[model samples]
Target: MAPASIPRRAALTARALAVGAVAVALAAGCVSSTESGGARLGQAQSWSSVAGGPPNSGRAHAAVSDSPGLVWSRSLGAPAIGVASSDGLGTFYQATVSERGCNLFALTADDGRKRWCLRLPTDGPRITATVDGRGSLFVPMYGGVGAVSAEGENRWFADTLGIPTTVTLLDNRHLLLISHLGIARVVNTQTGLDASSELPLAGEIPPADPGYGSPWCGSGERGCPAPGPAAVDTDSGTAYLTAWTPGAPAPELVAVRFSPGETGRLEVAWRTGLPEGRLGVPVVLSNDRGQVHVHSRDGSLHAYSTADGAPLWSTPVGYRPDTPPAVLPDGTLVSGGRTTTVWRGVDDDHSADAGPAPVVAVRPEDGRGREVWRRDDLRQLTNPAATEDGRVVVAVRSGGTDDEPGIAVHLLDGEDGGTVHEFDVPAARGPVSGLSVDDEGRIALTTAVGAVYLLG
Candidate 1:
């Protein structure tokens, strides 16, 4: 493999400065939260990390507006790679690609003004970058991870890891990076150096093939190039990742354990097989720590025990789900997709027609899934986000007639799956790139045409 290209540091005057770690205070009544993996990450305010921290529960404690209007929209003039992440301190960060190269932009959350834009030096596409509680940003590139201070200054770039597939913030001080070859490494957030040794995934990596086309890591078949993001359980010191290994016809959900302090050897705890299909979505864990949910393309949502990787139950979703499920505070699972069924009776013969997808809510009980409610009016729904007060927010693509596509953002009641409030995305496109909720109940939605909209 080729080495990562290092950039010049003419403007990085703080490269040699020893930045101290910032300490965060926790409430006295939150003892159970301290045991969970998210508490150590220290990002309680913003969508500081992807899928809202290491657990990837896709739940936010912030409250969102029922009838949110578009606060602002800015076009990147290029396509964006992933969703924009926000720092609770009033700044939003996004990454975009163009003919020139990859650029990371920091915009003011209130007004959408460019605070600073930094050009990233990488050989390939970059995954969604994550931020720490101290306002530092960690981006996964082709070969390594780059650390940028909250002030938009380059701090340090760790270039030893090879072909990063995902970069996850394990805590306030450590980042867990999975490479394209199914290898995991830990990096210190403060120093941008290797915190521990690398551990290979479930199976041995296949030999490099020069004939393969571009290795797109975003969304595709199971293990298209490498594994997707991981869901970490800090209480057990284990991370659940879905990977494709040799001799397995399909992908397997592998459990790997690592020390959160980034000072111990990474170990493989257990591995289990998933159904054969496109495995693009990451795994989600129940807040009660009873089950880990895997939404596979095989038209089913599988659950397993977190202690020993034992199969608990599997629920058929009726359609291939394209996004991860969001776990509400009451342990209810909310998932949505693009296709649905509509029955048409012709001459007493019932035929099925394709209609807009419905957002389904399921409750796990007695080792089986019980359907709670379904909302069929929403169209082209993105991955859903849960608010602290038990509401679901999703972006719907409005089919338009002309060149410009219409977009609608919906807030649903968690109990009955009813539409509480709805708003339109002004001057946007069809495909919704990403959806995230910040600590202040602010919503951020990104589009394929490089459009970013902030709603509150």
Candidate 2:
């Protein structure tokens, strides 16, 4: 484990800055939006502190809220994939499994309390979950999509033709899901109608090669390829998905629009050839003046037009950006890695004239970004969450090794990149995921092993 390289500020010159500016202008005029919003989103509330002493081992995800308390914490077996939080409910949702089968849990925001647990019928090797505006949790199970109410009740389930990959909330009442076989489905969040008709694919699959023998296959057994993640726009009924074929050299990116129809329209928005290697899912920056940011394992950030899938700009990022980039309300793009860098706009136009280079403000103008302040001393993995009182809280641990395992809460000065306050929560072991904050300013963290901590 080598020290992550620090980006040289001097290297980011006039030319590169100009490119960023151009990218923003281009995105402003060309990017388009999709998705419809119906439900209200929640926010975080309180505080707590977990001290270092015991050795608890289990991977888990956490959620918090001040009005109610600490939400629930769920375990993700040995290796967890992802965790998501709902706006006002104080309920944290995560996808996990034990020997029985894949499970989705809805937990209370005040304590490590379980609200409702929904178990899948089949053995699902991979799973992902997200919440709609209406507070329903949509999870992608093995071969179908499972809808769970915020109160922990099972709503309904929709079967899919292929292995389910990703599930995302489209708006308050609509949801979108994609499968490994390149099938994208849109369902009415309230009724669970097969809104697939409202999408563009129209039951067409990307051509497959017989000789390729399922590029994702292995050892005489079918190895399900890691399906690309899906991103949605709550304001408009638009969805974006990316997929790569076994024989194809690059990942295929697709954009689709969803509305009130049976047969939706599908179009090959944009396709870019990627280098030979495993690629992460394409994350759509909904508030990003209409641009899709694709992060590659090779440490490259590629920007595409949300409207037509046109390639806009490509730049090198710090680490293999595992988490999605955080956008502030002021249109400042705050992406965290070895270090967090703030971009003023979305495109290739890099003009110094853009007013102070888009510092990480708490709010972004495009409603896509907020300003950010960074702590160069702390190493972080996921994006930091902002408190209602304007403090940006991040989850950090010892940068290089497992010996010094801990989580830190740094209060950032929203105006300038200044540190307002710092606190540390000791951990029993190393490698913790599922970090979140409650309304009262208490910090909740889940370790790699199955212990949950309430840190203030």
Candidate 3:
């Protein structure tokens, strides 16, 4: 009888894992953040990180006008799998998720020209990238979190217990990441090593122990598993994340409070359950100052006090929330669903759709959103992008089947719901990571095929 044959690569991988404990400890020398992650160059655009700064407010500081021609469109020649980010140094960071090569490109925001491209250690279709205020680019890839200097040089790679989700830079020194196995860890941004726990994700879906796995870590899945990205409050040092445990009726929103000073400490600040997963990714909406909002997958919006997990207000946003609510300077709360809805100021009991309406506005105290305006024919599929000039920007698809594609960028006056200006995009509008706006009001929209449409 022939003996069972084991894959050579599998055997080597298992053996390697066994000996890695020593290597990780020896190589875990720490480095300090060479510079402050919050330092912004004068030329830096207001949009700092992917989620637009630690409070995780998705609004651009300033929204560009509606009528504008495409500045430039550059193709990485590969699918743009993850989110895009920028720093104070005028560099836009984008990554290509390709197996032949996964290269991180640094492009000039002025003309979208490639400054430099670095080949990452492994395929990066799932790699998430972020840049600090000082221009350090960080990404989760090749089984660890990696940092690239402002000059585009590979700095260091730290081993994580599991393939991490989108990393959150709490500060120049501490980084927040969670593995698919449901373990939340704080790694020294300088060292990538978690001395306290190793919740690995390479081989086992849930690992050998169930406690190490995330709530929804699939057993039959082929690749890595982890909860989505995190919503972090930099000033308060609190991070909000969500997860689903198997057999559980609802998902869990966990707040991790970081004690950052001389000692790096992480503790669960609070935990709550939502009706469904509708809250969306990086589920918490925080200003990092006073109030935090959490949306349930069940079309419910709940606001909580940041100091202690106390309920401030609860509003039922009739339609299921597809994106986080963006707050304008004037205090208007903007969100999207089947139609564009606005809470004149987070003050009303704005409920769902009543009739066939395009835009609705009401006060949270009203308990029902009143349809302020309607464009019966237009179907908006994106969150209402708030602008400084008092306009809600939306990307409208032609509803043209995939074969006949059209994306119309629309700008509506936030005060009167009037069309400010509209531009047609030649790119296909399948779905994107939401519109990216800079301090200059330049808007960027990337289509399904990795083509970026920039408008100023």
Candidate 4:
């Protein structure tokens, strides 16, 4: 099928989509395993889920271009939310909100045309969906989990006890859904049924202290668990997430193991306490080692062993705490942050802030994080994706101090943090809210105002 151009609103259709012809190699940090000990057909080469697929290692193997040109752009009726997922071959899935419910759009990656849009009346706020090779999209929403086919049909819906914070693709047949109330459930992708019953992630919790360190205290709520997505290790059937009771001493990184079978179960593997701070992004796994890293809002990055959740190391990178680090193929981690400023408003009437933010690279060594390089230029970098050449690609809100006036796509050398290539987005309506790089070197970005752009 030839890709169509649909920059404006169009009628929704339940048309069948053709499977992509091109085949891509597996991404760097993504583990795509099948029951037959082979890679899955369409999903193996795709950025199938958030954070560059299951482990949420924030890594990929796309080609970086010296000058990326826009391939196409389409505007949704509402702004897209969360990280967009791509099937890598030729389709991308993004979600936008409406008054009644959520609208999930399946756009052709080649020309930014919508293949179909499925409306979900009970779909929750976040729209990060997980896609499989057989044209299945498993979405976690407010009331429950909904499965949609590639031809834009509602396959099934499984209700959950609480609102799911994130949906992670665990393996070939199962998905891991973590909810806000510390509930974890594994659902079968094919049947859309619970493989495991609702399991409380909080192993043993002390009674709640009404007004002590509890955000839900004022609202007369009993429990408030830290909300974020889980990172899965497909090989070991282990998934990691941050769990904290409102009045608990400290938050903990919890690892849960899911055994898939007729009697599938979700069991807590281990838990490790972290310093007092809100959890930042999703927990990320080290690409080469058995360590999992957590970024705390207090500007500290903590690493722990996956086997027992033992403390590995803690390092401070005093910048954008909300952004997670991207693990490269060589085991180096890259993250972006802002610089420290002393006496900000004292200099002028307006708050005089620091000029250039930093993009730092650190090597996780034995009991230490060795600083590799720091580039004090890039700012507002989305969760970065490592390319095939060990380089990093990021969407910068602003290219640099005097570089570009609008949103820019930057390809930086991972070795020295130098700009290898940069291109400004022609008509960016809003900030680059979501970025996903595919196996064929195509960079897909979504704006806050619902514009989706593809460049290569």
Candidate 5:
């Protein structure tokens, strides 16, 4: 099949998914050996998961780019429709949703070897894949979420809970998820089922206001944003998110306290209305320390206490960031904008809204930032993918042009924002999607078409 262009709508033709029956006995953050796989993948949490590390931090620890070589690349044979994840040790995973069906592949990151293929009862719109701390790869499908063990054994599966958001590995015992409907469910990784039929592992979102002028909380599958995906703190059993409450003037950041065990239910602990007269672009960012960060449409960043939705610091940047800032291991913020950092971009001005802007690393303390570095030539930058070893991966592309090369992936020193090296995208075009790292410090890019690139 030819590589696909950006898709219009993700349509899944699969039937009700089969969630394998796994007996549950959550004994100290471990699952029983029901899986056929001998042992888990690798202990190297190198670049596991889509966002990079366990909490999906989008940060890795390995020094991968210095020895630049296209170790290998694999063509999914179809356009990849969603973000990609890696076990980091070796196994890399992604989903291909097409007119036929949703195809999931577990490829060896070291050599692009096809280790296992897991197909689901769903096709594309947008699905996020994650690798459990223990090594199980999870894919959120239309009817249910699918889990495959490291050794290529089917572990468990469950339903199209609702408009699905990405999965978060909260802690050893529980897996957290939020549907488009704003309902939250906690899955027992060991049991693969809720504690009881009515254990109440669900939460509800605020009702939507029909009177709002703009379309509310839209995603790839359904644009209606009721309860968005959350930044969870497993220790406190708390979820921080934003929802467009009905009858309200705008969306508000909500802190929900959830019951941890099978008896989990949602409770709106507290919520703060987003400041009015901004773009209303609400994304939640969290670190292990319990601080929740969100970027407003206006040139400002807001920090809030995840405990009670208390305000922390509100620093004003000059430009509205297009995406949530990437948090480095040291807690510096990397955000995109026009002239907020020290290094001014040298790219000549054009009419594009995204011109030669600087990719800056800001110290979260005072909302002050310094130019980590900027490629004057590379205008529209992808979110910076950082590794714990002080290296950050950035994918850049020219704004508003398809004929030119799509995106160039670069490795930079997170400390000084120095360029380590750049990877070549063979036949690259269009903007790149899901620029992420795995446990091995290898960077992966899913093209607008169906190809997946693994560079280190």
Candidate 6:
């Protein structure tokens, strides 16, 4: 599929102010996480109930439960930086900018009620926040980590050097934080502090004249480095970070592991030089699958072993592969790229079967994913959320040929990408970024403007 060239409009009114406030809050040191224990404030619930694709794809997932109804929409004093939804906990969190600094909000998921809000002192635009299994929200600040309770109270804080990139709960008590400079830290969730040990980078640093630094170094500066996303293994308590050389011809993908013990330590586990070119985030498949699937921007898929970082196989999917491979329950890998080719097959230690296998059923020995069927009607930018029984839901933005800009929801048969239901959302103002299905089989879509709509 060709890149959808939707004209970029000015930032939404609410988002603009929200972003401005976020910058101020970050500079003032106002952001922090919660430390006090309360009623299991919010329980982590599965967003989807559908099953039987590879390992990573959720069987039962959450879609927009409410329809074209406006739960609540507020203009951030600045631009909106990030948005996240907690497990069935009637609330979703958003990071936005305000005049004072960066602000975080806990809004009622059902009616968009403003449950609680916290302000930070940063002015930077790049912000990432995540909620743990215990309903504790972790916000990575410019030089530290902030913890907040679900009820909107500051718990504890920790300081660091490099800007934090990703934060995840290693367990109920430990939080893993990754920085752009290749630094990984494990913090005690209860204390809001890091252990003495820290991981170090192994390879030689590039000459830092201009563009010779890490990708994340130049986010706001001219011609800065572009950092890749980090993935963590929840069960092993290990964190993985990937990066490329400044001027390398073929991109080099490096994987390092940080093991937390009495003395925390980071070690270079395995590194592989790719065919040359930048790579995207490497998605880790959990449940002891021992495989890391990485999709490159140029449309290539590579699989690596989680244990030793050994390259298992590499294959081309299409011109611009955006969505990560969807791991079905039976071990059959369902993945699609730009060319309308949704590849499906069993994921073994062997190389990916060369030449597109005619969309067919594949059985996995592990009883994980069984390719029951394949269809060509399903096209999407993100991974298609599956239903508990066997339905796949996708979002598509229709290019306006003359006067109409529309978005459509297509339900596909899980076995084959056959169309099951098609509904067009008229008067859609922008591109759709998220598509979710509720427990009652209602489809909810989130647009770039932060408007979420329900499709029949």
CA lDDT of every candidate: 0.66, 0.43, 0.54, 0.64, 0.54, 0.46
Which should have the higher TM-score, number 2 or number 5? 5
Clash number for each model: 0, 93, 24, 0, 25, 95
Tens digit of lDDT per residue, candidate 3, span 1-456? 010112223334323432452354346433324464556522134555545555555667775765866888777776554445667556667765443443577777789988888666422223436676666767765455676667665556665554455467776667776655545667766555563343222223444442243222211111223344567776777776565555556566666777765556677777666554533334445433556666664655666556665666666556554445555555455555331221112233332221222333222333332334444454554445667766777766554564554677777776666778888776554544346666667777654346666777
Determine the C-alpha RMSD for candidate 1 after optimal superposition of all C-alphas.
8.6
Q: State the lDDT of candidate 5 residue by residue for 272-319, as single tens digits.
A: 877632332224455555677776656666777766777777766556
lDDT of 1: 0.66
What is the C-alpha lDDT profile of model 1 across 1-456, one tens digit per residue? 111123333113212221211111111111122123233245546676657666777887688886888888888786664667877767788876544543678888889999888766432232466876556677765345667766666566665334555577666566777765567877776666677787878355544541121233334343343545778776666778777764568777788887654365688888877764444567788898767888776677888888878889877766655567888888888885541111111222311112355688888988888789887666644668888899999887565544555778889999998889888777766555578887778898987557889998
Best by lDDT: 1
- Looking at model 5, residue 211 earns an lDDT score of 15
Which has the greatest TM-score? 1
* Residue range 51-156, candidate 2, lDDT tens digits: 0000000111233232322233345453332333433345555444333443455566566577766544321222335554345555554346655555555555
Error of 4 at 198 (Å): 1.8
- TM-score, per-candidate, Cα-based: 0.82, 0.64, 0.74, 0.80, 0.77, 0.67
lDDT of 4 by residue, 44-142 (tens): 456777677777776775766767788888778775555677765577888765543436888887788878886653233235777776556777654
- Model 2 — TM-score against the truth? 0.64
lDDT of 6 by residue, 1-456 (tens): 111111122123223434543444455444334443432332234331111111334334433322223234443344343324343444456564444443676655565567877765321223435664445666765455666656665555565444455566666666766555445567877666676356534233432321133232322111122243355565565555455443545444455555667876656677666563433333535335666666555655566677777777655544433333454444445553221111211231212112222222222334233445654333353345656565556655444443334656666665666767666665554434444443334444555444545444
lDDT of 1 at 292: 84
Scanning candidate 3 in windows of ten residues, the lowest lDDT window is 215-224
Poorest 10 consecutive residues by lDDT, candidate 5: 337-346
